[model samples]
Target: IYKHSGELVAKHAFRVASGLDSMVLGETQILGQLKSAVRTAELAGTLGPKLRQLFDASFSVAKFVRTETDVGAHSVSLAAASVKVGERIFGSLSNVNVLFVGAGEMNRICAEYFVSYGIQNISCSNRTLSRAKDLAETLSGDYFPLSDVAHKLEKFDIVLSCTGSPIPVLGKRAIEKAIEARRHKPILLIDLAVPRDIELEASELEDVFLYTVDDLGEIVNDGMRNREGAAREAEKIIVERLVQFKSQLDRKKRIPVIKKFRKRGELIVQIELEKALSSIAKGERPEEVVKVLSRAISNKFMDEPSRALNNDSTGEKLSLSEALERLYGLNKN
Candidate 1:
């Protein structure tokens, strides 16, 4: 429902790709996510010419944002944030039994963060049991099928989920049952899925603290004061790049107009040359024929402008006259 000029729309995309407008200031995850989105659109054949150009330029801007600035110095990621939440809630993670759902890149990253804290109990649950086994083996933890997650939910103190499921895997009632079975022990659940692996209503349950992708970013941004200067510097780079891209876009927009104008001039030249050739063939003087050709071409060029000035019904005709005078130097005499 929103309408914006191409330049303004591109400006927003450029800022977002640079992580300047991210919920988590200078977070690196969004760039990967944007790349994935573009790839998906490409596969689906929905990536139009302008959109493809926008994303391609955006990726370049993101690269400059990272290399040209110190914004990447403070890498407070959602995985780290999830670990922070566990530490805050449990006071100690060495004994906290962790359950990771969907062994994707996000889960692997979060598992590594938890491992860094010296937590030993980590389990992986995924639809592909083999994938779960691979991640669990890497993390030196146990593995289970995702189908068993709901039944075994009460066994873990913390659960981190990121899946490509079309529907919510953990419903509100299931969470309530798990909380009841755990005897009111609090559970920290983080869902980093696009369609949400956990139910939205599950967040309302007691003894359950649920944080989504956006929630993690908002929480992480609160502690990102160190990156503010780097963010400003990155913005300067984006502005410079945007101006260059805008100039390119402006030139592209003028192509059709320039082509049409040239076409009209060529047509006028062709008509006059044909008449001049016919007059010469009928034994007219070559110099007189050339003179007629030049005058006819001049008049043809001026015909539209002369009619526009004479009609002058619009109040803005003065501006049109000014433009004509400026373009042709009609006042030179």
Candidate 2:
């Protein structure tokens, strides 16, 4: 129902899928999101040949940008930013005890970043114990139920929560108790959830360093500015890709025309060949049959153009003869 022109829509979709329009510039998540959308459209049979071509070209462009540019050379993902913030607070992530409060995609990505620093003391707690256990095992960490999160909170120095909880999962009172149990040691609490897994009041606690999704946007913006040069290079690549996509679409559109033309020519050849063979079978002269075949073929090929030229009723300045002469590059002499 959106009424953008095809060129504009293609450009916008390509930019978004390529991460040029992302909050975290050059982040890989948007590519996956775009792929998922395309797959869904394909499954629903709504992705026709043209759309398939466009999206395929888009994927190629995204891959080209990622491989050819340094756009994603920093911590652009919010999950990755959490690890950076943790390192900033503790100097090194390897020595810190990290507790991921969810086993979803974001938490998994965050855990991977932390584990890359060789952080051995990692834990995951989720409503579904199996999913949490799977995530913990992948990171070589421990898993606990959501109910045990409050009691176990004091054990970890850095806690990152990304969940779909409607209400705040960790309240100020709960975090304050954890800080007390930890002898007032500072805890980095990253709330990646939309509704906020950690209560807003927890930010007021002196020992609880709380950061929400909005806070992460500042880091993501800094990354975007840093990659501006790479983004410019990516835009150049997109221009090239756009040219290629349009050329391909034009060529595809001409396929039926090309086929029809070729079929008509082949049919004319068959008719001429049949007439020449019939004359030979009737004992007509071989040289005469050859002359008749060539003449018949030429006439058949030019019949439509001759008829169109003769039927020109309008007294245009550029007559049909002049048009045909120009079209065929005929010498006036």
lDDT, each prediction: 0.89, 0.87
Q: Write the per-residue lDDT of candidate 2 for residues 199-254, one digit (tens) a residue.
A: 99998998789989889879877766768878999898888888888888889899
Candidate 1, overall lDDT?
A: 0.89
Clashing pairs in 1: none
TM-score of each: 0.56, 0.61
lDDT of 1 by residue, 237-306 (tens): 9889999989888898999999999999999999999999999999999999999999999999999988
**Top of the candidates by TM-score:** 2
lDDT of 2: 0.87
The stretch of ten residues in a row with the least summed lDDT in candidate 1 is 218-227
